[model samples]
Target: MILTVTLNAALDITYRVDALRPQTTHRVAGVAERPGGKGVNVARVLHALGEPVLATGLAGGATGARIRRLLAGGGVREAFVPIGGESRRTLVVAAGDDEPTGFWEPGPRVTADEWDAFLGRYRELLADAGVAVLSGSLPPGVPRDAYAVLVGLAADAGVATILDADGDPAYLGVRAGPDVVKPNARELSALHGIILGRSVTVGTVDGAVDAAAAIRALGARSVVASLGPDGLLAAAGERVYRAVPAEHVAGNPTGAGDAAVAGLARGARTGQPWPERLRDAVALSAAAVAAPVAGELSLEEYERQRAAVTVTELR
Candidate 1:
């Protein structure tokens, strides 16, 4: 079973409008809400892939309760620690004219006692987990090394851990030696303090490959750098794999990375080869992008796209 940890869970609200004008009123054409946070998104995609997963995180207040309900409704197993503050709500306004505008509220502050309780719960869950995913940002009052500690604990339990985060948490988590780390182009650039180019066109695979190698030098066993429309580049041990999407499907792109992480974890659990893992990751990511909501993808769509995923070996 995969154990997913989300320190800052949220009720994600997404609104679609025909056009968005700053400081002007616009009627929304669609509104959808779901349990969100990077770890939750990963668990949702894993569930969609028929994997056994347990989502563990912090939750509180009525909003947190709603998040749990939503996860349950989506057939995800969850174990969230109750806290004293309310979970946050993130608003995403998808304007037809441009990229979506995201407004996020800071999550609840967790007291020290609450943090300890969560650690205890996590240790208990780790005993049964095959892989553990530590994703998303740390909430207020949580230390920067929180994910690092969790990764260590998972290591002690003999469970492979995957980390997906940004900023200090990501930096520290990598230092803790996770089994795998997934970062996008921007995040990878931030971590290594160098620009990895704006695009991975045909002429740029060499640069991308070099960048991925640098990421592996950071101590992670494997580094999977997601290149958005160009698909993904993964450096696993001594082999490098590049996967291209079967075809472009137009839709919202949120949660596609989390879906990719899920695919990679599922592939690892099944002992799949690098090429197969890349294929699964690309197919799942494309399916998630084609979905209207974040983190939710149709299994049928994944099946249709899986056969079309094209993977190439770079080394």
Candidate 2:
């Protein structure tokens, strides 16, 4: 089973309107809510793909209850550690022809006791997990090296790990030698700067690959960097491959990275080749862009795009 950890899980709410204007009140056209946070999003995508997944994380209060309820309703197995603080909610305002505007609430501060409880739960879940995905932001009061700790534990349990995070957590996690590290081009660039004190130009596949390789050298077993519409660049072992889509699909791009992480985690669990993993990840990411929300993917688009993905080796 694939195990996913969301340190800061959330109830993702999307509101659709005709148009968003400065300080103007309008009737909402539609509203949708789902269990979210990076790892939760990955678990949702994996479940949708018919994969056996168990999502575990920190959650509490009414919003956390709602998140777990929605997960159960969606048929995704969840095992969250209850806490004293309430979970957060993320709001997305989608206006016609305009980019979605997001308002993210700060995560609740976790107590030391609550964090220890989560660690205990995580250790137990790793026994049945073939792969563990540690993702998202570290909530207030949680250790900054949270992902690093998870990655190390997964390694000790003989389960491969895929880490998706940014900033200090990501820097520390990379040192834990996860099986895969999934970051977008911009995040990769920033991380590259953080780790090596060097600037990496974003939007160029070569630059992304170079930055990813630098990260891999720092203890990550492999690096799979997403290049938005351009696709994915994977640096694994002594090989590097580029996976590109035949065409771009337009829709909400909120969960594209998480979808890619789902594909990578699935592939790693199955021991697929790096090229094939990148192909599946790119296709899944494009399909996510064709969906209206963060957790859903268009199956038709997935099938079509999967076949059309081009995977080429890069020097």
TM-scores, all candidates, are: 0.91, 0.96
TM-score of candidate 1 on Cα atoms, chains taken together = 0.91
Model 2 Cα lDDT, one tens digit per residue, 225-290: 888888888888888888999987777788999999999999998998888888899999999998
lDDT of 2: 0.91
Task: Residues 230-265, candidate 1: write the lDDT tens digits.
Answer: 899888978888898877778878899999999988
Residue 264 displacement in candidate 1 (angstroms): 0.8
Look at candidate 2 and tell me the lDDT of residue 43. 95
Compare the candidates by TM-score and give the number of the best one: 2
Evaluated at residue 137, the lDDT of candidate 2 is 92
